[model samples]
Structure formats: structure tokens, C-alpha cells
Target: MNTPSVELADQVARAARYLRPHIQRSALEGKRELPTPCADFDVHRLSEHLLGSLVAGARAAAKEPLPADAPTTLTEPPWVVFPPLLDSLAAAWAEPGAWKGEALFAGSVRPASFAGTITIMELTVHGWDLATAAGRTFTTDDDVIATATAVAAQIAEGARARGIFGPEAEPAPDAAPLERLLALTGRKSL
Candidate 1:
């Protein structure tokens, strides 16, 4: 029987697959610029970052070497790049004996358990970012949103301490928990 954590990882894998096609349809070509929630990135660059991050996470998950062909220059349109990368990631995560129980990055280390949770949160939030950048909208499944919110709340303390929420912004009283969570993380929606 699969562990609950593995089950959740599988769910995330499925969602990533579902998101791939929509992400590929996003307008990320020349001359048509779209805005992104990330202050420093336009839509295309944000997508590239997301893809790079996904590749990094996949490498961590599988304990595999980073692909030699991975794009070092982060300028490729996400629609042109992410599908194959994400597909490879999904496959890597799905393989038996692939998901290591621990990962090391730079001078830090983390459990694969937490890594999967973080992946879920990253994909959900970045999915929202992609949709916003494209001037489109997409809804995450309730379970995924709840999971992301929980993960976000857990990480918010550190992020908040680092002034991620900005100095003068109080949490919105009327916002839903998820909305508050996103707002606290500096994402105010599309």
C-alpha cells in the first residue's frame, strides 16, 4: 500500500499533468507582454523560473543528476519549455525507489516528506501566478488549495519575519484563510 505522503505526491503529479496543457496554451511569445505578480518578472520570465524550480525539485526528489540539457539561460517562453521538463519530473517522481527520504541543497538539508508538500504548494501558487500573468483564471481543486494553504501557513512565520508581507500591510480581515495566506505571502490575486 502506498503511504499517504506518496498518495499526496501522486495527486500533485496528476495536477501537474492537468496544468501542463493550459500552461502551454498561455501566450508567451514575442511582442505580447503579460504582467506577473512577481515584481521582477514578466509572464514569460516567471514561467521560466517556475520551470527551473520544478526541475530542481525533480532532481531533489529523484536523487538524480540535473539534466545536462536543462536551459541555463532562463529566457525561454514557458509554453515552449515547461511541458517536457514537467513531464520528466513527473516520471522521475513516479518511479519506484526514486523519492529519496532526504535531500541536501547547498548548506541545507530537508526531508523528502516536506519536499513533496512544498512541491504541491509551489505548483498551486505558481499556477495561480501563471494564470494571472496570462490574464486568465484557473481554479485549484479544493484539496489542493487547502493543502497549499496549510503549507503556506507553516512557512509564513519565517517569510513574514523577513518582511515578505511588507511593513504597512495588515492582514485583510475579510479575506478567506487562503486569501489571507496568499496576501501574507505578497500575492494579492489576479
Candidate 2:
């Protein structure tokens, strides 16, 4: 099998660092129960979901089998678990062979690059979701924003059908790239 592209793997690593600050305990204070743009998920629930997804992404990158009954929700404080989970994901994807073949994602076989790209999408989008819920400023480099925008567009239709994303909401013409990306994922930028 051909090696998975390093480009997306690098993006995943950058994304992990990009997301770390947003999930800090101090940033999330008093905002645990606040609702986010990601429908039905408050800040805390979304945090748990993000962490769980990171675990799954790491397993996928490492070509490890997913547990039959992995818990979707986290019992531990998300801020505490978030950094390490991000690190795990980034490190797993950085492995030279990680992207060499098909990997399991959401119980289906997909190109390793697909899994990595999706992970990047999750980190950026959910990072925005968490920061927005906490009334914190959210920002990322233009390249990351561009990559996320492309991913959001690629997955918008299928993701909506799977309930991973809601129906697309159009952003204002003058909206920033990050806001436009969020709109594609059915999130209203604050």
C-alpha cells in the first residue's frame, strides 16, 4: 500500500496544538453547561465527545481495533484528558506507516488520509464549538482554516445525513473564513 500523505498528518499535529489552549480548564470555567453551536451539545458534553473522537482517531491511525463497546461519554474531566488525547492522536498519525493503508473510521474502512483529514476537521470544528460556548475568542492560522473549510465542504452532505453535522447555514457575505467554515457545518458563529 502507498504511504499516506504526510500533509494531512502534519495538519493533525498542528491541529492538536491549535486545540490545546481552547480546552484548558481555565478557559472552560463556569461554561460547562452552556449550549454550543453543535446542536444538543453543551460545552461539557461536546468536550467529552471531542475526547472520545480523539481516542477513536488515534486507534484508527495506529491500525488498532476499536473496542466493541467503547463509551461515547467521558467520566473524567475533559480538560484534563483533552491534551493527552490530542497528543495521542497527533503522534499516532505521525507514525510513518499510519497512512499507508485503509484504516477503520466510524466502523468503515477508509483511506488513512481520510481518517486523518476527518480528525483535523473534528479538532478545528470542535475547538471552535468549545471556544464559542465559553464566550472565548477562537482563531487559527489561515492554512488550517482553509483545510477545514475544504473538509467541511467535502463532508457536509454526508455528515448531515449521519447527524454528524446539521443542515448548512449560509454565512453573511462578509463573514471570516472560520465563520464561513462553521456555517457550512451548520454552526452559527458567535
Candidate 3:
């Protein structure tokens, strides 16, 4: 086990906090199929991806072997299960080993820091997606938003090329922090 970066783990935990309630709100509102800013994913599919990513993050944090066929969609209601899954992801990332080793993601071995960075992006960006689709407001701490924005900018081009994200939407001159983050992820404020 290798020592982890406390700041990175803190970001993951904070993002989990930011995302949790919106998921519950979306589920309670029964807006699973509504279109999200992601374009390709409805609220349900995006929630499924969030849940799956949390599971993978926890497993990777512990340095456990990843499943070759992890499910991308949830059979259970996301709101019912996602809170705990998000909690576990935060807990796993908090561990010392999670920051120092390589982790498997999308069938590739990536630096553990890379995995952690994307996990933050997943929670914040998709969290915003779910909230928007459900017609709810989303917000997060400044530091959390800052880290997410940096991660988004770092991976935006590659993510776009892989079709995971759409082409970047231009933001207004005075776009807010969250809006800027969303734009980098190819989302426009709804």
C-alpha cells in the first residue's frame, strides 16, 4: 500500500456529497428517462454510469483486481443504492494506497492519480447532468469545482475523441464556475 494524497481524497469525498442528494431528487421525481446535457445518456443511464464508476473506484482503491465485465447499468433504482456506493467510493479513495498505485479503468492500467481525477469529474459533471435533467439546481464547493474543471480541461480533447464527451460548447463571457466546468465537458447550462 502506498501513501495517498489527502487533498485528492478530500475532493472525491466532497464531490460525492455534492452528487448524492440530486440523485435522490431525480429518483423521487421519477425523471429517469429525461434527456441530460450529455446528449447520449438519459438520467437513468448517467446514474448507472455513476454507480458503476463508484464501484470501480472503491475496488481500485483497495488494489483489488477489476472485473473484466463490470455492469454499466443498474438494475436497482439508483437513488436507493447510489448513496452507499458513493460513500464507499469516498472511503476507498481516502485510503493511503489509492493514490500511489496504478488502477485499471476502461481495460487500461492508469496511474492511480488519473483514476482519482476522473472519479471526481464523474461525480461532479454527471451529478450536474442528473440535476439538470431532473430540473433541479446543482452546486458544489469552490475547490471541488476547481478540481473538476481542471480534470475536465485535461481530458476534454481525448474524451471528445473517444465519443465519451461532445464537442465543447462555448460559455458566456461571465459564465459561473459550474457553467465553465459543464462547458468543458460539452454541456451547456440548461
The TM-score measured for candidate 3 stands at 0.91
lDDT of 3 by residue, 1-190 (tens): 1223898899899999988888775344678778888777887877777778888888777777677676677877877788888888899999988888698775678888888888888889888888888778888988778887887888888999999888888889998888888878888755
Model 3 error, position 95 (Å): 0.5
Error of 2 at 68 (Å): 3.0
What does candidate 1's lDDT look like per residue over 1-116, in tens digits?
A: 13465666675787586566557653445523566765556666667767766877687677755566866455656666677777776776676655457764212577665565
At residue 103, what lDDT does model 1 achieve?
63
Enumerate residue pairs that collide in model 1. Answer: none
Per-residue C-alpha lDDT of model 2 across residues 123-146, encoded as one tens digit per residue: 899988888888888777776777
Report every candidate's CA lDDT.
0.64, 0.82, 0.81
Which 10-residue window of candidate 2 scores lowest in summed lDDT? 1-10
User: Per-prediction TM-score, please?
Assistant: 0.77, 0.91, 0.91
Model 3 lDDT, full chain set: 0.81
- Candidate 2: list runs displaced more than 4 Å: 1-4, 69-71
